[model samples]
Target: MDKEFKLASQLLTLLDTEQRWFTLAEIEKNLGLSDKTIRKMVEEINKQLPSTMTIEVSRGKGIFLQRDGRSRTVSEVISSMFRETIFYRLMNLLFTNVGRFSVEELAGAMFMSTSSLKKLIVQLNNNDLKPYKLRITYSTPMVKGDELNIRYFYWKLYGDAYEFTGWPFTKINFDFINQLITNIENEKKIVYFINSKRRLSFLVAIVLERVTKGKSVKITEGGYPWEKGAFHLPVKALAKVLEESFSIELLKSEIYFMQSLFSLSQYHYYEGSEMTPMKEVELHKDKEEYQMGNRLLTLLAKVYPNIDVKERFTLEIYEFFDKLLIDNAIPEWMTISKSNLTTYVQKECQQIYQEVQTCMQKWHTAYPSVLYNDFHLTKLTLLVRSSLRYKSKKAFLVIGEEFSIRHYIANLIKKEIGDQLIINTSIMKGLTDEMVQQHHIDFVISNFPVALKTVPVVIISTIPSKRDLDNIRKELLL
Candidate 1:
């Protein structure tokens, strides 16, 4: 077989035994196929394979190989789907990174004419699976010859025009822009800060303009860091706009320009700072940290969790912030960070114990005899505390029924300390999920421990029953 065909076959072989889907890029990397070769091979395979089998293309998403004997292959139906061109890939990269795009920026990224992009966008919109839609409109000064900077585009895109236009050229609606901004901001893959600034500036400007019009603005009582400019607009007008548009109540807080500066500095620091922290890691315990010390691990994992963290950290800080503020108290325009977020996370973890202890004490007072017992109270306290600050807090608790007491220890962990711990009792007659619907299990526990850590394995006699062992082994094959 040719190299690309050989690679495709190898990938199919690898996939045949498993019951999980993979993205196109992943398959290409694993099989060592260039984009062109892979697409050609996939097309050939589509014609050759049974009607049930074909390559599934998710435009702007990715590709997957699917086999369903029962259904006429959707891939076949969409087989005539236009092959993704270089521009498609380029546009996907840019648009997927930042939700909205200006003609200039889009042209720059694609290295194409602005007019060409606009034409392409029109064609793209007409496609059956038009994953992205483009909207373009320009606002000239009611006065002529006004210099149009980046802000001009921003204002136009998010200003009153958004509401009027539909399809190819719709007016910019702030609500839609807000939704787009929120979606892009939270996404892990795209971190386009420059575009983000443009988006945010528009939202801030709109909010500011309403307040200045002497309209009724509702400003919250407690101050915020970004409240100075917020006050420039009338409180009555602000409140009305916030309530109507965002359903948020405004709070009185001065903007922390210094903190913003620091955050910006830290962003740069994070980009270039590969320097390891001065901390020794006990490899015998959490061996994954041997390559990089604990200090580096903590920084890398927390700050850039998506790319860096092998383990996922459950952040309930947003929930905490939500509770701290009154309804709609914090606007999207406002951003805040702990003085030192890294240190803050560690300190907050430490404090969970005290917080839990306080709750337990409340339980003690409410039902004295039931909870007052020292053993129960202590166990509850430790469970709560340990759950928060547990070493490898981000990793799973792998429970193999070993005579070494580790299995029993994991059980004790659940019995003593609940909620914060997820005991993946996979070794205990673990009914292997063929297609482990990840949605069913807690992410913190459901991950394969072997992939999560690199600790040595001594497969002791205290292993789970043969059936359970077989099941775990089979699942590992996937």
Candidate 2:
């Protein structure tokens, strides 16, 4: 089951969405296999399926998954997801050590000859490790790179591993970590948004363990400068909890790191020490992260010189790309539910995908030690695609029988996809090519069937259905 898990995930991404009749040719195209090869993957997925969940196939229409009432469970499927052998062992060791162990200690513990360890380090460096900007210096024998990317790399190791029981859950004291999380949440008046909450707890546990080993992260570049401000209150509160639990006050840099966590996950922030949603939660843009973002964009711009990187959303996308490197928002729950969207992005946004692949390859040639997954490449591709359509007109015409109903459908579509799409209203109006081009509308949303010689039109219920929304998302994101 080597690439079997990947096959299951890629296939699931194709069929899971409402445009359910994903063609066999499409599957074969995206996954790079024949019909026979695809069927074998379906069989593998079926073995893991509960009675309520199964992939249903139609010879002419292609495939879709049928869920009988309850949601599909993938504990069987996800549990089997892992890479094999040397890379796995090396990564697991890195996660356990963080900064606690040196190269000599790691090599000795892995029971490998120094030469073998050197070769593996070289191999990893020569591959995807370049993006993390990290390398193994034999002199120090510790992984050294940008601190934020290193932390994200460590988190990704936990993410890529098969065990779903949140590794730190097994390695750390559950009650102690949970209480620390609760103390922060209550004092801050925030919801810890399950997955990220657990990630924060796990991080605290790692810090706690590292502290026990007398390991403390130094205040270096990449951390947001710690300041005594309104946000500092929560950080101070959290630091107090940690001090009580660990019997030591956290260093200034540690408090700065904690401030980042709160800002990123916060639902709202206090303005003038008063809780208000009107004032946006301020996310600190570290000087190093901004430079990293600019450097990456500059590289991509070198490859695609004609594309507009000056757009506000384009800059935002680079920041999004940077955050993906260090963000601790690793989802505790894993599924191929978004595989359809991810695969669609891969296929539809080929230009951006190729540009990113080239950018990564270019970096690899220079750095040679950055590790990344195909999934992240796909995610980054989506970010690039978002910039492609940034603030561009998305919905052209809304056709309906009457004024009230048409306006209502238009509003509903806006409510559902307002963030990703821009809908312009024209009721009882014939959507012509002239109108579409004039408005720069990408697609049409109509309660009635509307035809276009050059553009695509989607017919939907006046109120919009799941099928309607799904198809819209396909057009929007893919």
TM agreement with the true structure for every prediction: 0.22, 0.52
Each model's lDDT comes to 0.37, 0.61
User: What lDDT score goes with residue 346 in model 2?
Assistant: 62
lDDT of 2 by residue, 98-179 (tens): 6656677778877888788888788677665765667766644666665545555665555445334545435567777678
Q: Write the per-residue lDDT of candidate 1 for residues 1-478, one digit (tens) a residue.
A: 0233345556555555555666667777788777677667777667756666766656555566678757643333322221223333443343233334566666667687877766655554454122112332322101111111122322433432222222111233556545443443333122335444343535454444333332223334443323332123333343445456654444333123211221222111123333222211110123311322233234323422232222222111111222222212333212221222334333433343344445545534533432122222233333333223322222134444454566575565455444444544444333233212332332223213433222222132333443333222222222
Candidate 1 TM-score, true structure as reference: 0.22
Candidate 2 segments whose C-alpha is farther than 4 A from its true place: 1-4, 19-21, 48-52, 56-62, 72-90, 97-124, 135-147, 159-167, 213-215, 220-225, 243-249, 269-274, 278-478
The local lDDT score (0 to 100) that residue 470 gets in candidate 2 is: 58
Q: How close to the true structure is residue 314 of candidate 2, measured as C-alpha lDDT?
A: 48
In terms of lDDT, model 2 sits at 0.61
